[model samples]
Target chain A: MTQALVNGLTLGAVYALVALGYSMVYGILGMINFAHGEIYMLGAFHGILALAFAQHYLANFSPVVCLLGALVLAMLFCGGYGFTLERIAYRPLRHAPVLSPLISAIGMSFLLQNYVMVAQGSGIRGFPMEFGRRLTETRFSAFAGAEFSLLEVFILATSLLCMAGLHLYIYRSKMGKAMRATSQDRRMASLLGVDVDRVISATFIAGSALAAVAGVMVSMYVHAVKFNDGYIMGMKAFTAAVLGGIGNIPGAMLGGVLLGVVENIGIWFLGAGYKDAYSFIVLLLVLIVLPRGILGEQVSDKV
Target chain B: MNITWRGFSGFVFVAALAFAAACGPKGGAGAIRLGVAGPMTGDQAAFGEEVLYGASLAAEEWNERGGVLGKRIKIVKRDDQAKPDQATQAAYELVSEGVAGVIGHFNSGCTIPASEVYHQNNVPMLTPSATNPDITDRKYANIFRVCGRDDDQGRTAAEYAVKTLKVKKVAVLHDRTPYGAGLTDQFKRNIEKSLGAKAIVYYDGFDDKEKFFDPYLQEIKKKDPDLLYFGGIYHQAGPLTVKARELGLRAAVMFGDGVINEQYIESAKEAAEGAYVTFGPDPEKIPAAKGFLEKYRKTYQKPAGAYSIYAYEAANILLASIARAKGTDGKAVSEEIRRSPHESSIGTIRFDGKGDIQGSYYVMWQVRNGKFAALQ
Candidate 1:
């Protein structure tokens, strides 16, 4: 049971990191960023690729340095991808019928998935297991027999830090306030001298960078990355967003952690085959009982 | 325009007939045509490529050796897309092409339904990788498989787990595909029959599409099974094994033949060390296959994967059977295939009453030093 809790928390941390993207994009644009998962997938690919190149070029560099390089490359590449995605697929459809952008989001999701599938053959690839090896060298036991490796601790800590950083940025920073204003009323914010387009693009960049961190952490934890990893991960984070109130940031984090814990507890009783179903079941129950989610005060249905 | 049900049914019937006509194979008197069908595209395409490469190599060699029955053999390829319906269509297309015999439909789900089509047309169908026991249990005389059955390999795995590894508690998990679920069922049954139900600590399943197994691992860790048996393709087994080890579980991991590829070892990295798998006699080990392996490497620039040798032998068996029967007719070739023993790289291939290869056996393999070495 303790082990399940630890596993759930680790998993929930990654899900929350991903959920931030979905929740942030929805907070600002009132549209689901369906392509967020693909950005995460690319992040894993880029991180591993960067690690491989770094190891090859700088053989004597410490593992920490190589990993930091991987993290930076992944974040930069995913941020650029997120920015370009908005420019190409979402920007033009922003002013059309709301349905048009939603459809475009779904289409963009498939387009990115297939593009990656074609680029990387439908095989699982991995970063060197050296990351895991290094991670295992330092570990602490959380409780009776359930040990917490450095990787899990790092994932949780980094995720919390990112969430905290985003929280402070959104509440205290001028640009973040402008983003909040733009999200509130795009026309009014623009009239009040806010660059709405830039705010939306910045939102995508920040959200995608957080997702990239989650992706890199997951790849290292699991020891492999696949082209199709985006779909299920994306859906779970989306569920986390919806469960926490789609446009609420802290709610997204709370929902993600709760969903992961609930899923693990549910899997213990239901078995592993129904692992994916547990999230949906929780989503349904939440939708039926708490329509506005745990932290959500009311259903605005609009940004 | 309002359409009546009767009119719709007639339209459907006509359309079906026309579609059948379009897919029917054309008769070729110049070349003795042979067909290969498998998932040329999709997730399982690598397996299909194995069948294609090995079978094509066999045909190339036979043609170089003055062709079968004085006629140069031509190989026709079809993509089953790993689907039963597509396999059935490929079967019908192969029959229509007047191919003497076929060597395909890699997955058990595809092989089972598609073999019926080959049976109806009296064309011999020899699968290279499909291993479900019911595949040959259907008693189709035209159906044969070069690979060993799930039951055979599963029994081997169970015996290894009990008698060799000497593990007290065992947990079996499958991916819920026809191959995975079927193999797991057989493995569980054999384990229970040998060691009793209490010896088997836990049994469960997971969808093949699942990305993470930490939840399952955490729960299984509580049970403290010493041996974890995975019944699935390498894609899932590789990561599952890695994740299990990551959680500090010291359980010995074992799997079926689906993970024979070196890619499994690569993906699992150090975690793959000490893992066990059951497969047909290592083709690379047999002295008879040394030349074939060398030729294959020379041509393809890669080591022959698991099913490549099986496919080569399937092709050899089919062509030899056709030659022995002295015809390009499907019924005659199929009869010869069923009736006589033929020599090939694997060995003297002879079928049992159920059309499974006679004396088919599986050997254990272990990942040691990043390579799958045969475990004696």
Candidate 2:
């Protein structure tokens, strides 16, 4: 039971970070950024490439430095990717029918997925051992039967830290206020000199960076990365986003944690085959009463 | 509304494209074209490339000896993308091209349905890796595979678990793929037969693309089974093994032939140590295979894949049968292949009535120091 919860939290933490990005985009553009998962996938690949470079080409770097370096590199790369995606893919189609942008998002997702597959051969790329093997091998017990590996600890701590940082950025900062305003009313925010374009760009960058954190952690935990790893994860996080109320920040987090716990517990009762089915059931049951999601109506999460 | 030169040119171009499609590359100018089909361009491209390269090597060898039936043997390749619909399309295209026979299809799901298209068209289809029993169970005289069936591999694993490993309270998992589900069902049936129904504490199947196994491991951790069997490919198995060990799953982890790829050990890393898998005896130990292995390395400038040798033997047997039959007739060539006993790199090949190889054996292998070694 203790192990299940910890595992759920570790998995949920990554989902929350991914949901945060997903929610931010939906809140601002009023469009689901289907390509967000692809951004996450790209981040994972970049993280591994950076980690490999640090561990092999560079000399005498500590594992922490290498990891942090990978995280930063992944964030920057994906942050730019998100910004450029908005400009090239989303921005041009902004004035078109809402469905047009949604379709564009889907197209962008495939484009990025294929781009990664082409750039890096479609083989399952492994992480540097200093990071992947050494980390997972080192484990510490939480209680009598509960053990948390370094990879899990890293993923949980990093997700919480990123979430906290994102929360603060959205609430305590001026740019965050601009974002909230834009999500509520794009034209009005633009009329008020908020630089809605800049605010939207910032939103995508922030969401993408958080997704990068999740991506890097997942690749590290699994010890490998693949081109299409993001598709399912993106969908799962989107479910989390919808459950918490599509655009709600805190809702996305809560939904993520809840979905993860439910999935793990579902396995406990139903067996492994029902793992995915449980997620849908949770969404349906929750939507029956709170359709917008648990935190769907909250103002803070809209940003 | 007006008929212009531009419209006329576009119409003419479209007509030309259709005409070209209607008659594309007929039998490579009098050569006996053997179609090579698999996912040559997608996620499973590696396996398809192995089929191509391996069959190409066999074709090159046969050409050197004097082409099949005094005609140069030409290899025609098609990309199935490991999809059922695309596989059938590849099969249709291959049939339309008037090929002698096909040696391909890396996945059992693709092979199963694609075989029907070949069967209906009367083109012999022999897969190198597709291991589902139904592929042979259909007893489509036109369909066959070089690899051992899932039931054979599953029974071997179950027997080893019950007797050699001395394990009880088994947990079986599959990825719900035709291959995975079929193999897991066989393992479950056998394990239950040996240890009784109550011994199978947990039996379930998950999606092939699923990444999380923590929940399943959590439940299995509680069940505390002595043996855990996964009937799936390495991508899911690797992470599942890593998580199982992480959650302190002490059961002896076992896998079917799907884990033969190095990616299994690569992804699982140190956690893969001590885990067991069932597969054919290592090619490294086959004395007859020594020359082919060496030649494969020398010719390709790379190590042979898990299915490469099987593909080579499959192609060799097919070509040799075509030689003996002295024709590209599907029924005659397939009949000859099933009837004759040919010694190849893997071993002596002899097909039963259902077009299955005789004496196909599965051996237990353990991962030690990040590599699989056949248990003595």
Candidate 3:
């Protein structure tokens, strides 16, 4: 029982990381960023590529330095990709019909997925064992015979740190206040001397970085990555955003953790066949009962 | 408007004629067209490519040896994308192209429906790897498979699990694919009948896209089954075993023929150390396959895939039958296929009433030294 909870948390943390991207974008733009999962996938690819390069070309460097370099590269690459995506795909269609941007986002998702599929053949690509294998082998037992692998520990701690950092940035930072204000009323914020376009771009950058981190963490945990994983996972994170009340930041985190736990628990009773369905089930129940989500109405109108 | 409509109708008639000319069969008079239909693209392309390689090799060998009955054998390849609808279309397109026979349609879910198209068109098909029992049970006169059915493999695995492994408790899991679920059902039935109801501690099927198996692993951990029978392809089975061992579960994993790919070893790594699988005779061990295997490695720069040798045998059967029949008539070639035994890499091949190979056998293989080694 304890182990299931830990596993749920480990999986949920990554979902939460990805969900924050969906939630933030929806908050500001009033539309889901369907391509966020592909950003996560691209981050994982960059992580592996950077690690491979370090392993081959920088043999004398310390492993810690190499890994940190890989993470930084992954985040920066994804941040740039996210910025480019918004400018080319979303920005042009911003004033167009609402459905146009939504469709554009979906198209962007497919474009990125196939781009990776072609660049890196559609086969499963493995993360270098320097971290994934070693961490999986390292286990920590804290309770009555309940054990957690080092990878799980890393994922949980890193997720908490990232989430905490994001929380502080959103609540205490000037840029975050500007973002919130713009999301609430773009014209009013523009009238008040806020750079609405700049704030939106910053939101994409931050959300994408968080997603990249989640991608690296998951690829490490699963020990492999594939091209088509983005759509399913993107949909799951979208579900997390919806379940927690779409466009609500804390709600995305809660929904992610809740969805993961509920899915695992549901598996314990109904078997693994329905693992992917649990998230949608939670989404439907939430939509039916609490239409505004757990924390939705609190900030739905505000952002 | 009437004048414009009349002109448009005339243009449509000419365009229709041009389209038909473009789409018509393009086989040369001196070429004996043979179709190889499978997932030449999409996720299952790896398996399809294996069939293509083996078939091409056989065709090249035969063509060099004075072609089949003085006509150059030409292989027409089609990508089914692993969908039944696409597979049916490929089959019809091949038949219309005036091909002698086909060598594939790799998945059972695909081959089962596509068989009707071939049957309706009277085109003979030799499937290298679709293993559903119902495939042969359909009693199509023109359909034959070079691989063993799920029941043959499932019972073989169950018998080994019960008698050799000496496991008192068994858990069966599948990915809910036709092949996986079919194998699971057969494995569960055989286990119940052979080892009694107490042997089957658990049985269930999961979706193929599921990545995490901790919940299922935990549930199986609680059951404490000595053997976990998996009936899925390598992708899911590999990761599932990895997680099972990570959870410190001691049960040994056993699987069907679907776990033969190299990805299985890569995914599970050390966790795949002692996993067992049942499959048709190992191609590398066949005495007649040594030359083909060597040339395959040299040409492709990779080891021969699990089904490549079977594909060679299927191709040989089709080409040889076409030679003996002395025509591309489907009924005559299928008649020759059922009559005379053809000597090939996998040994003498003759079809029974159900169009199944008469003397095919299944064997057990174990993952030893990170590769499958035949088990005695």
Q: Residue A169 of candidate 1: its Cα lDDT? A: 88
Give model 2's clash tally.
1
Q: Can you rank all candidates by TM-score, best first? A: 3, 2, 1
- Backbone clash count for every predicted candidate, in the order shown: 2, 1, 0
lDDT, residue B376, candidate 3: 66
Docking quality band of candidate 2, CAPRI definitions:
medium
lDDT by residue for model 1 over B60-130, one digit each (tens)? 99989989888888899999977778989998898888787889889887888888888888888899899
Q: Mind giving the per-residue lDDT tens digits that candidate 2 earns over B224-330?
A: 99989998877778878877886678998999877777778877778889989887778999898888888889999987877788888888888888888889899
Best model number under DockQ? 2
Q: What share of the true interface contacts does each candidate keep?
A: 0.60, 0.48, 0.26
Displacement of residue B371 (Cα, Å) in model 2 is 3.5
DockQ of each candidate, alpha-carbon based:
0.48, 0.53, 0.44
Q: Which ten residues in a row have the lowest lDDT in candidate 2 chain B?
A: B21-30
Q: What's the CA error at residue B161 for candidate 1, in Å?
A: 2.7
Q: Which 10 residues in a row give candidate 1 chain B its minimum summed lDDT? A: B21-30
The DockQ value obtained for model 1 is: 0.48
Sort by DockQ, best first: what order?
2, 1, 3
lDDT of 1 by residue, A1-303 (tens): 786788789899889999989998888888888889888888888888888887688878888888888898899999999999999999998889888888888888889878887898767887676645778547787777776788888889989999999999899999899988877788999999999999999999999999999989899988888877888789889999888988888989998998888888777767787787888888888888988877766536446
Winner on TM-score (1 vs 3) = 3
